[model samples]
Target: MNQTRRKRRPDPSLSRLDSLSPEMLFPAKSPSLTSSRIRYIFLLLTFCFIIYIIFSYGTTFRREQISSIARSLSVFSTRRRHLLFSIAASHDSWLRRSSYVRLWYSPESTRAVVFLDRGGLESDLTLPPVIVSKDVSRFPYNFPGGLRSAIRVARVVKETVDLGDKDVRWFVFGDDDTVFFVDNLVTVLSKYDHRKWYYVGSNSEFYDQNVRYSFDMAFGGGGFAISASLAKVLAKVLDSCLMRYSHMYGSDSRIFSCVAELGVTLTHEPGFHQIDVRGNIFGLLCAHPLSPLVSLHHLDAVDPFFPKRNRTESVAHLIGAASFDSARILQQSVCYDSLNTVTVSVVWGYAVQVYEGNKLLPDLLTLQKTFSTWRRGSGVQSNYMFSTREYPRDPCGRPLVFFLDSVGSDGTEGTWSNYNLHRVGNCHRAEAVERLERVRVLSRKLKHDVEQMVAPRRQCCDISSPYNKSMVINIRQCMPDELIAMNT
Candidate 1:
């Protein structure tokens, strides 16, 4: 019995050892360690995901913050301006490198900065602008130290795409050296609505008193609200005229050329001063205000010294002091919305179509230009050049004789004309075209012989060959002694 019991006990112990699973025992009871490893991997994934979320949130928050800040501050400026945005580099360093960012960050123009970011390469970015002013104007050259004003304007355009996107309708270009104060400008804007038309340029001295239909326009100082198309035309004029009129590329004449090329309805604002400062500021909105004194050519900076940087501030203070203080100005108003950029474009063509019964030396050109300009409380195309005249008389009333469009009987039909129907007899389109061309050449000769008779007394008296610019095709201003047609 003892032997049997001892054998059974050993058998039981052997069986217990054999009953354990090979995988369970081989791994060595490391359940806790396995659990710890899985938990660690899960924790690492969670941590990484959380970090990603936070970083993403931070980036989004920063953009929102910038947009929010811009929207908050631009509610009350006198001029509604656009600020375009763009990242010019792959990293933030290039943005920091530009002088624009420095000037943008400057306290003086701090309000002007909608964004300063690192946009990579040649791409453009336009941000929504804060309509800080009630009246809308554009401030493109916000920074100093750049030969490319167009680039600066491009940047500004990028910055101000979204603000007042639907209502933001105009652009006024002023320099940093001008008397520009955000608060006062805003005050002025709020009081008057400039979105009524496509363009409104500054005033120039208007001295011609004797010419028929001759506008006694004030000297247009330029740099005012123009249609997007007019602005484009001005740029094109600059490009083309720069090549043609190489000697006359100064800002002043170039500006005049731009105005002429657009054939925009030109009028002026006596308030838009060219220079505002001191005694200049005293009478005008600022010192040397354009109206106070058209332009201060007399300031010979004490033996030809360069103008100080403070000139901008000087102009700003002087202009700000008086222009912003008008009693008729409106109070600032607030709105709860973001300023986002809106895309804008302007397209324009030659002001007249001779085929439409318009005449060479066509006043119809001027009439078309004048009428095309979007008027206050009127519906019109933006590309129509605007005039700044207070009177409702022909806004774009300028003589348009597109002699260049003619090749003189090239298309034949003898330049068909109702005037010569009896003399030349019925002709085909080609013969009529040719006839019209012959008539054009003869009329031009006749006009050359009687230049003094056709043109106004002033222009005719001073120049020996003033008719060089004139190309009379049909009847003068195409009038059967009609007052409306004859006046121009």
Candidate 2:
């Protein structure tokens, strides 16, 4: 009867629930704990985000560093594509000298621009593209007897840089008559880092010329190379440099003065020959320095490189052998025949000299003065940069000389070069030496790595007894501790 009085027995579950806190009872919508829970979640999310950002950035930086290292160590090889040739020439000389350019310049592989004083009908597709140099009349030239063209020629460095060629590493400059052994040039240039400033070339062979100009100057006729990085900086400041060096004698002197201002000195690469001497260069070519033959200049001023051939023919002849093994071209390899008391000097791809008696290596290295001084003078003016021994006046007294006749690749890494005896006269030669009419040189194609190029050692040669009027000589890498002497 009394629903109101029906104090229902207190349910244990209801009592327990009634005694619990609201936060515990209604857990999902509890406001008191919401703020702290949100704060904890926010802190956790922030920490994760920070870690993610740091990891992402660190990963990118590490990847970039590794990529840079790989590029430097693996992909930074210097090749022909890295070189840009800037040939200085006049309209008058280009016609005659273009032959020399043709010998080395390859349109498909070699990048070059010939800066002529004026544009001519240079329609030959085989030659390098010709561009007329900008007017240099604004610059002053005060050298007493020097041509004003020196200013124009010196500006070729700037002009070449303005060309905006992409991926260039070096800018090589030379006279029109300069004949480049392009393959060897690439090898020599690969020895240096293109990212740094380098002025690589050699001085004139004539002592007086070096004194008059500078021992540090790179004779333009011989050719020189400027690293692209330095060339760009030099281009911006060359005009001011030219104005200051107006009294300089030649274009090379102007370039040298400008480079000196930039704190760059000549890195003498003995391979670039400023053949300042006139007449026969047989002696010079026979005793080439223990380096790759890079270039030859003043061909027109000197006699034909080979006797009985015209100048162009002789150069083509040399290039013919160069096409086979450019690194070995004109490389001197001395080997002695101890049993016969004979010494043989093989100018690979060029000539061979067979001597009757054993000649000292140092003596063979000295250039014979077969050519006259650059200038007709006595004493200091006649001096040369290299050591010289008097070339016998009589041809009969000289060693039996043989010139390159033909060369062929053996299809394996080796080549065979046949050198025919260059008969001077009926000289009294040792029967053994007289019997040989040809020299057959067997050698592998020279492939120099960076280490070999940096620390080059002369190659060793082995000589065989003469047979059938022919002598066989094999050229190979020198063994450890091997000596290039009579006894060795």
Candidate 3:
């Protein structure tokens, strides 16, 4: 029995050592130590993830906070009633005037005053607007047929001011082609008291002919606003003033000259855009502005402001979208294109296609990658592209970085890829490359121009006001030559 037991036990060294598992044999580790190592790795990963999240969403958070505060304070709420006058030509095709007329014909249209040419079926037709004929007998001043409309401006001012609604604080005037963002206009006017005489408007000098007019003159096409007090003063004296400037080349310059006689200088407001360009102004509209966009003129020739195939639908859509918070829209909306060619950046939640005249040579993907890496390294957080779901896809068929995708019920958010038909197509690679290069160059230049426009600005007219040295500065009035000389 003893011999059999010894055989079963075997040699202690060989049996115990050889039969034991590797873990047991090699100095059994503390279970606590293994758990501690795992904990350490988990903590490191968690910290990294937190940092990434903060970096991505910090700006968006701050922007939203600012917007919330502004809304809470009711900075945009104004008790004053505003009256808008849309000047229209009688002979112009209905199609040409239809868009602008229909634009103001909303609940807001109740406040608008529309003037049409006399002796036509178009003039006789009743619309939503407060219809008024461009009656020659309304005022005594009439020079040439060309200046006939110009002569009527004072009459319109007189008619509006005479209505004597104490609530009416502002009288705005614009061409038939002008499109007003009513909310923004109200915000701008709220900064000034209606009791004081204020002539607010923007200037234009893209053309050499613009130099012929007073540098201080506000372009009428861009639209101009007058305080109630000033409108009253003008109502009494405008006919006399018109007689003096009857020979002036343009109505806007003549009006400016007349206002100068009344000791009221043009209060340059950059929000009003006089878009005199013949082609699409997508870039100009999409770029950041020094102030809230109040109006856009000359919509007759440019591409529709919104992203609809039908021009009429685009205008209607734009008017509808204008009801939201302008500041929040500007900050939150981000748009980009895949052709890497033209990128339509959203300024105030509005984007217009921007094409470049010159082509640059750079790999768009490479630039994007570089920018991403730099942003990460710098710890700059971005939540411009958001996904509520665990997994998000780019439907626009564009590179993931281009535009933001809409958050949906399916637990995912992505761009509407079907909308970008041109991007995913089998277009010529060479052409695509060329266009992309142009876009790169234009984007860089546009960025620089925007920076310059928004930099610490001092107005030529407001020398008493301290020069601001902030990133978000108002558009300061400078000599017309300054803007005219720019290659942009």
- Judging by lDDT against the true structure, name the best candidate: 2
Q: Could you give candidate 3's per-residue lDDT for residues 1-488 as a string of tens digits?
A: 45544345556688577677544544335653365666676699899999998778779897998898875554334542455454544445444675675664555334665665544444323443444554655444444555566666545666666667655677888777777777667767777666678999977624333555666778888899988778888878867766676676566776677788889998888788776554444434434344766887777666664443455665555555444333222221222223333322223334312222222211211111111111233544322111111111332333211111111122232111101112434434323232331111001001112344346231221111221211111112356554211122
lDDT: the better of candidates 1 and 2: 2
Q: Lowest summed lDDT over 10 consecutive residues: which window, candidate 1?
A: 342-351
Q: Give the TM-scores of the predictions, in the order they appear.
A: 0.27, 0.86, 0.54
User: Looking at model 2, which ten-residue stretch has the lowest summed lDDT?
Assistant: 22-31
| TM-score of decoy 2 | 0.86
lDDT of each: 0.29, 0.89, 0.50
Q: Which residue ranges in model 3 land beyond 4 Å of their true spot?
A: 1-80, 84-96, 108-110, 119-127, 134-147, 205-209, 306-308, 328-345, 352-488
Error of 1 at 96 (Å): 21
Q: Which stretches of candidate 2 lie over 4 Å from their true place?
A: 1-57, 74-76, 378-380, 466-468
Q: Identify the superior model by lDDT, candidate 2 or candidate 3.
A: 2
